[model samples]
Target: MELVVYLAGQIHDDWREQLKQLAEQKGLPLVFKGPQEDHDRSDEIGEAIKGTQPSSIYRDHTASEFNNLRTRIWMNKADVVIAQFGEKYRQWNSAMDASIALATGKPLILIRPESLVHPLKELAQRAQCVVETPEQALEALAYVFE
Candidate 1:
């Protein structure tokens, strides 16, 4: 069966592409959804579309609400939620995605380096499995289907 998977968090890297390629290579039928890929565009889209707000906070709030709308809708539709955390950025959105997945009864796979384990223990406890690489995430996805 085809899977609707939500790929969340860490927009700076190419992890989503990597995961999608892995899925294709392994013959997994997955439809991936997530926030916008371009970090700058994601940040600026609100301003661009809505016109520049009087203050930065207002602009950001507007943008965040729009983003949350898209995310929440996709999250509800997802069969599995895979959130990846990278070393550089503080990915608050990733944590939120995981929590929503758990609350909504969708399986979750969290990907992050070992260095993050200690800080993310609570989040880890919520996941179906926590893995350190894209390959491991792919394996987790396969296991989910099985």
Candidate 2:
């Protein structure tokens, strides 16, 4: 079966590459998408909201609304949502994406670094499974596929 893997975390290039590798090694027909991968207009929303002044409240609101819509769309299409959360990589957008996944009844897998205390531990607990290592993450994905 074709699966869409949505990896939500800090929008860093290296993180996306790593997740892509993990998805590849799974040997499944998986399409990986994330905030950093920006298949939609997420980047445009980021640019529109960047450094917004108090006078630009309307623009900020519009950008936020647009981003929410895009995130919901992505979440709806995902077979599973894997959120990477840690003290250093915690992001509001990632939390929002996780929330969307929950609301849509999508399987949510939360991954946190083994060494660090997860900043969003409570949030992560809501996932279908909380895992530390990449292997654990893959195992969680396999469970979902089962």
Candidate 3:
């Protein structure tokens, strides 16, 4: 079964890379359909246009819309959806994704750092497993994939 990791939190490059490594170590094919991945180049573009005319600034609304569409498509194809709710308190997007996963009948694995207070702890309860560590997250993944 293919696993698509839809990371839903502040896209800390190191954290994202860690999750990617985890998937690789597990030998699972992973797809990350996150806004951060889609907007990786946006910061550079924004910097380049900082001094340019407001009209000259590039605003790719279509890109974001398309990304959302792609995320839903990927969610449908995924065997499991791992919602990584990092220490940060961003809940709206991840919550929505979790809801979608539940609606689609896909197993949802919610992960958070043990030291942080998870804002969506309630929503996490609805998942197949709510893990506080990388090891626990991996275990949860193993159970679901099994």
**Backbone collision count in every prediction?**
0, 0, 0
User: Lowest summed lDDT over 10 consecutive residues: which window, candidate 1?
Assistant: 37-46
Candidate 2: stretches off by over 4 Å = 36-43, 46-56, 114-119, 143-146
Which candidate tops TM-score?
A: 1
Candidates ranked, most accurate by lDDT first: 1, 2, 3
**Each model's C-alpha lDDT?**
0.89, 0.70, 0.65
Q: Give the TM-score of each candidate.
A: 0.93, 0.73, 0.67
Clashing residue pairs for model 3: none
The parts of candidate 3 lying over 4 Å away from their true place are 1-5, 28-63, 114-118, 144-146
lDDT by residue for model 3 over 26-100, one digit each (tens)?
876667655545445543444344433334234444334545676687788777777766665555667778888
What's the best-to-worst order under TM-score? 1, 2, 3
Question: Which residue pairs of candidate 2 clash?
Answer: none
Show pairs that collide, candidate 1. Answer: none
Error of 1 at 77 (Å): 0.8
